[model samples]
Target chain A: MKNKVIGNTDIVSGILDEQNEFTSVYSKGQAWLNELRIAGKNAFSEQGVPKFKDEEWKYTHIAKALGEHYHLPHTYSLPANQDLSNYKLLDANTVTLVYINGIPVPELSDKLISEGVTAAPASDVENSSEFKTFLGSVADISNHNFSACNTAFLNNPCIINVKAGVQSPKTIQIIHLLGTDDNDSMCFPRTLIHTEKGAYVEVVESYYSLPNSNQNFCAAVTEIIEEENSHVDYYKYEDVSDSTILTTNTYFKLQRDSRSESFTFSLNGKLIRNDLDIKLTAENGHAELHGIYLPNGQQHFDNHTLVDHISPHCYSNELYKGVMGGSAHAVFNGKVYVRRDAQKTNAYQSNNNILLSDEAQIDTKPQLEIYADDVKCSHGATTGQLDDDALFYLRARGIGENEARNLLVTAFSGEALNEIPNETLRDVFADKIHRKLSVMSH
Target chain B: MLNIKDLRAGIEGKEILKGLNLSVGEGEVHAIMGPNGSGKSTLANVLAGRDDYEVLGGSVLFEGNDLIEMSPEDRARAGIFLAFQYPVEIPGVSNANFLKTAVNEIRKSQGLEPLDSKDFLILMKEKLALVEMDKQMTSRAVNEGFSGGEKKRNEIFQMAMLQPKLAVLDETDSGLDIDALKIVANGVNALRDGKRSFVVITHYQRLLDYIVPDFVHVLYNGQIVKSGTKELALELEEKGYDWIKNEVAV
Candidate 1:
């Protein structure tokens, strides 16, 4: 069968069986993790997978894509000759952390030596108490089915910590490569980032799939917490093969006077859904969410974001742009919330899209829920085709039609791409986008 | 040289240019003077191969190539340029980047090597002087927030940079003041090299005073009704277009 379904109850039943098998193999010296895993499993069982009837998942039907039998494992061996230098960001000082099939291989990681900074796989610190305090604290697994499922099947979670008053000079690059060897496999990759007071850091997370690999499904969750007075810039770039399905959820928590900026660049993928939620829990916090997704062919990309202002005097801004071509489809749902006690909150959200073909489409919704009387909030969304006048303007200047389209698209995505804090990483993303556009034109 | 014979074109099934005829020789500047709705802009847009206008009948020949059969970019590559009546605004695309891409594409089509960054910047700088354009404008998004005069100057700046064989200026001086008009006229005049032709379209004789066209044509109701020397522009200016309409009606 192309898409084998196990029904809702059967899926949760399978998870319970996998949890028992995992407990027998991985619960050695990690009873606390097993307890957390049990809690996550119970949550997933209670809330099964989201179907088309769900309000938040109305546009995207995830059940069909997840209908195939999937294998959940802690680790898998990668090809010895896996070359990743092709994906490295040029001219950026990066401490590369490479993961093969949800497990981190220390041999493939760069030896990091910065003061008050800790970067390693979660499996290495199974005995640390900090893991229990930070793992399920940030991400809301109770309400999110994908997050709960990911937490229940956590393998080798990549955890990054920056101590108070410390600033990392190099960006920590996390590269996850999925290789299934034709098994129609599945993996869950977990990550947690905790920055103490007055700390600063930049992280780049990228996901890729090996060529000729089996059809795979990845359920990943990354939780990030910024303590008081901390600053963080997080960038996620997704460039996977056409045969894989990726559902990733990231949560960010900002304390008083802290800042958080995150940008997601979805270049190419098949059935990708990204969920990003940020919570400003203290006063004087700042958060910026920016993303650009350029999809072609039958690729489907969905981005859902929530910015919750839980405290007073917080600021948040979001901008997302999409360029859909061929028969591709995209969905963007952005929601901003200003709590009743969050007075003087400022939140702004905008999502813009350009559809290149008659069949290509996008659905964008920007929402604002404000309860505080003293707060200022605004949201807007626009979907349109490329401006015909602008296209002719470029073509009349001796530029070919295809090149003109590429230029306009590259420029369309530039608004969000240029906001990347690091110039080197920004150029890296820009270059990838340019390459993608050229390929699309051909 | 450019030639248009019995060119009939329109948009939305409504004929705009019924049966127009015009010709421009090498090293000559031809000014197309007409009143509002006289198909002046239509003629210019048709020459640039704009797809919106359906050429019902007639042919446009430029340097032995059928301009009617070519795409807009091909017409441009074949040294045909149309300075728009209203330049379009493109956000996020820098003027410099747009110009560079246009220049390189044209050069590549002609089997010429694309200019390197340093050489391209030097060429842009030289052309900026021709239009008195601020160097900073090149780094800004293309006409994103440019004033009317600035947009007009930018068109001429691009014309100067591209240096097309036949440049069609469509109402290039409509909203400009005296000072801005002078700069625009000077910019166009500086590019008038031997063998380069221009078809300047305007409703008034104000712009022709600076460039001083060799031949003047008055277009009325989709066709050229009168053709003469530069003095004809002053005559139309003194007598207004009512006389031309009356003459054409007869």
Candidate 2:
């Protein structure tokens, strides 16, 4: 069986044999897993979510990320009184959903219900074929163990939907604050988002780790479906504990005249790998993928983006910038595929990096495969240190050599931070950059 | 106060400044005119501490200290400036921020408090106007995508802000229209003072007409072959460098 059931069977056998009575989706999940396992499907083993053995993952060793078996969050408890002031939405009129350790904390939000926005824990995602199919659809799970593992055991997810033509000027912030007690724990977080025709909204998946040495494994899968004329700007602001490992997979489908954008900023993680897939499935659909990752110390951050042009007259542009210091290593793999019949497709991608230290390393690759003749597609990758003349110029003006170099490095990273639209989120991203620079200096 | 005694330096062991000697004390603009391949650039690079060029033999005394022992940045911190023939391009670093950082670093080396953003802005505005540069240039990355004229203007702009004790303009007027040349000259002129000195090296005498130096020395092969006053530049312009080589060159 080439279907998704066998993978679910392995998942059900590992985490759900004893407690399978809570939801019907869980039962169906096991049933499908049993059927697929019986059929003995193994065609996808060769395509294991792009591995370190693959040229694309040469720098970022996902196998190391996959090797670590994380402890499941055994329990959940919202501190009787925790602070949410720092995470307040930029637009007070916007809705807010708070989740602490994979469970929704409704007490943290009061104005969301009155704003006509629905926010809840996704305990039944397996019931929605669109949701389950979207998770296993784009990602090459066989290549990525965390993605496949996440699909089998996702306990709860955040579900968000924007109705047709109802545009909210404010933003929707999905806050995932990993607690301090569960040091060395992991969780599978699935988020489903849908925008109907002519709908417009912005979603910020903001993560923070309460102070602790916990090696947190957050395998989150986000699926975004945009109807005709719909627009969705999905911003992912990841700030997990520096000692933790994070793997997040996201897929977006853009219909005719629809627009989808995915922007992410990675900070404070032991190892963070993100897979972003955007498919322009209808004529005139557009997608933009932009992100900035500033890694310090021995942290490892990787971003793999795939923009698939499936129809004619579609457009996609991707630019990912990185500033790596200390002995930290960053990896970027951007792939653009212009399908056979996707004529008149416009796709451009570029990855540029600034290595702030001799010890710092970065591996960036841009791949463009176009079968369509009437298409314009281009890609380029560059990595280097600050220019000597610029450094001397600053020094000649009386600036210390190190300070001048730092200023130049910080400025080089500003182009990517500007992509995050929310002011609060932008500030957070900038603050992380500033903090990274400060740490790199020492 | 600068003294170069029998200085000789070169790249890849081919000796350029063979026993070159020069002396300048506070408040002097000395021009060094030369044909191609003279040790004029070698002298400047030795004093400025460019590591790629080797100092085969030299005793460069800055005020009193042995200048040869210092690193290039230390030499700069000690108040030596070399306006490069070809300025480097740095993307993503603003000119204003770069200058402010340089000014503060030099000041700190001299045991002074760092300049605040407000004071730095005030200083940058005035120096930018001196080099005929707009405020926008100050916000742009240093020499990134700048024309030759703008790069030269930025060089002078940096000189004005740093107020170096000794400024070495190494072929600063090589690629400029008359207007940009005049602007660069004005920037240098405005920075001239009793406590400051300049070593203006050029291939043409037109720049000397604008800066009007106190001395003009002709460098040939690897040594200064002729020495004269401001009139010598006019003579070099009218008689041409070949005449000097065939007539008085040593």
Candidate with top DockQ is 1
Please identify model 2 stretches exceeding 4 Å from their true place: A1-59, A65-68, A78-96, A108-111, A123-145, A179-184, A357-359, A422-424, B12-15, B54-57, B65-78, B104-125, B220-226, B238-250
What is candidate 2's lDDT per residue for A36-87, written digit by digit as tens? 2222123223233334555555686655554434455666665555568766
Model 1 ranges off by over 4 Å: A1-7, A73-75, A90-92
DockQ for model 1? 0.90
| lDDT of candidate 2 at residue A80, scale 0 to 100 | 51
Tens-digit per-residue lDDT, B120-172, candidate 2: 98988888889888999988987889999999998898888888899999999
lDDT of 1 by residue, B29-106 (tens): 999999999899888888887888899999889987899999999999999989999999999999999999999999
> What local lDDT does model 1 show for residue B187?
94
lDDT of 1 by residue, A1-442 (tens): 0112223665567666776787678777455667677778777777777877777787888777667466664446666776779667644578999887677878878878887888888666535557789888887777788787887876567889998999988789988887577655777888889999999999888889876677788888899999999999999889988888888899999999999999998988788899999999999999999999988988899999999999999999899999888888899999998999999999999999988889997988888998899988889999988899999999999999998998889899999887788888788888898888876621
In lDDT terms, how accurate is model 1? 0.87
Candidates 1 onward: DockQ, in order: 0.90, 0.44
